[model samples]
Target: MVTPAGTLALLHTSPVHVPVFDGLRDRYHPGLVLRHLVDEELLRRARSSGSDAVAGPVAAALAAAVADGADAVLCTCSTIGGTAERQAGALGVPVLRVDRPMAAEAARYRRVVVVAALRSTLEPTVSLIAEESGPEPSFVSTVVVEGAWELFEAGDRDGYLDAVAASVDRAPLSEDSVVVLAQASMADAVERMSTRRPVLASPRLGLAAAAEAVAASAAVRAGRD
Candidate 1:
């Protein structure tokens, strides 16, 4: 089915993301339409050969969404976030990284703990944090939850969350540190984690940002008309 003209299309790399994003969209932007396009291979390719390997395909997906009448596109995979942002101008609509708002929030802290299931997400997420933090000096540390992705791949979501939580628990986190969940899939694990530090998750913040972008685009078009 063709999505409505004002639809917010989410480009995802995991099938499990549909319900999570849909729930967020329903709660935050119920009036707006929603669509999801999953490309599992994109993440796999990114993990194996780096984001450059999936940049072209990701750009194509964005272009297709725009052509299909998406008002805004949310790249829900951090692995391809840089590529999505690079192609945003050409897409003629907002193409936002899902971790953007979380990164921005993370930048406010003097120190940040970035937790991820995959190594591929570290660079883009840290770069986003730095970009948002801008000129201000901040300390950032990365913790990759070993074998967490394997659990996720095996459909053992509970195991995945437990592993992530365990990894965070073992890290030398303090009350002053801000913990950033580097991947959207890892967002739920934060709640399970016991930490005094503030935890940042992407889904709600990112979707809210995308909703505002869609509204802004519509306003601009209405003004032109």
Candidate 2:
């Protein structure tokens, strides 16, 4: 479907997230229109250097998504999410980072174990958790699920998810620790995990926030009308 005005634009680094978010919209927010914008280069560039390397493009992408008639932009890339949200002053419309809600939830716990398939995602997700957790955040542990990203790159999706779930399950954590799936691709691993700790993923939480943003924007527009 065309991305009509007032639609929630999803900015993703990987094409894999399109169906994931679309499914979320279908099940939870059926009335919410979604537009998926995938730019693998943004993530590829960030992986090569760092999040700083892709800040300009990330900001540009958020602006472009809004320019294309998005009422709100939900950036699905945790690596560049901070950059996208920092543009709130200029973007005018709401820009939601998918991981923020997850991060906020992670803050409430005494310890947060962040899991991801890619090495590049560890720092960004961990740092965001701390930033949201206030002046003194919880002790954060990171587990980079080895070989999982390679499986994903090789199109072994099930293998990738299996590796992720297995790695998180195998990680040593206190029963009270909160587990956070740092990447959107790894969200589904929750169902596969045997870990007793609370696990949080961004897809559903992020999209729900975007749905609210869309509603608030519509409300404002109606008042203006």
Candidate 3:
């Protein structure tokens, strides 16, 4: 059996995506090869409304990984996510952004609330999901505590969840509403806060999709060889 290989070029802006990818690796196992690459500063700058200037470097790094033999690329960060698609085209391989799946799902509802970890993730995620769903759902966004990253670095899991959940719970969601986690790291909280509405996580969806893409690519390569 030829062990398959895939790389999760995580544009890890924060520590949250680490656990998200870990969950994916645990669930998918040997069938889906996986790893992560972190570029912390780029993510922070991108989340702060920095232009594709930051994304360019991150994409270049990912492009290098693909050149290095990664069969597929999975980007787990929400902000600067649009870069993934562009990188995918440039690399000529499967590249998936964390928001794509949840965006598709969230679009099915009439109204949606996105609990993004950062302001930069909110609009892009909502817009992408809206484009897919057609009837463009109403959108709302809320930022958790400003220093949520500090709390995370301090190993305050409870504090991190509390701040995120609180921000999400307070958002003005529609009466008939759907909720989506803008960032992959927010998956756990999505499950915990799935009260009164549906909560979707991007990392879970992106990873599953990426696993399939990598598997398909490997199968095709083997057939040709």
Best-matching candidate per lDDT: 1
Cα displacement (Å) at residue 218, model 1: 1.8
Candidate 2 has an lDDT of 0.86
- 1-225, model 1: which lDDT tens digit per residue? 222236788999998999998887666667778889999999988889988988899999999998987888998999998888788889889999999999888888899999999988999999889989967756999999999999999999999999998888888987679889899998888778887678888998998888888887767666788
Find the 10 residues in a row with the least total lDDT in model 1: 1-10
lDDT for model 1: 0.87
Q: Which stretches of candidate 1 lie over 4 Å from their true place?
A: 1-5
lDDT of 3 by residue, 1-225 (tens): 233654445556666577667766676645565656777787767756564777678778788878776777777777777776677777877887778887887777777777765667777786787677775555545454466556766888787777777767776666778777776766677545646777778776777777777777767666878
lDDT of each: 0.87, 0.86, 0.70
* C-alpha TM-score for every candidate: 0.94, 0.93, 0.85
Name the runs in model 3 displaced over 4 angstroms.
1-9, 135-150, 153-155, 172-175
lDDT tens digits, residues 131-215, model 2? 8987767999998888888999998988998998999889899966999999999998888888878999999999888888888
For model 1, state the Cα shift of residue 211 in Å.
0.4
Give the 10-residue window scoring lowest on summed lDDT in candidate 2.
1-10
As a TM-score, model 3 comes out at 0.85
The local lDDT score (0 to 100) that residue 223 gets in candidate 2 is 78
Error of 2 at 184 (Å): 0.5
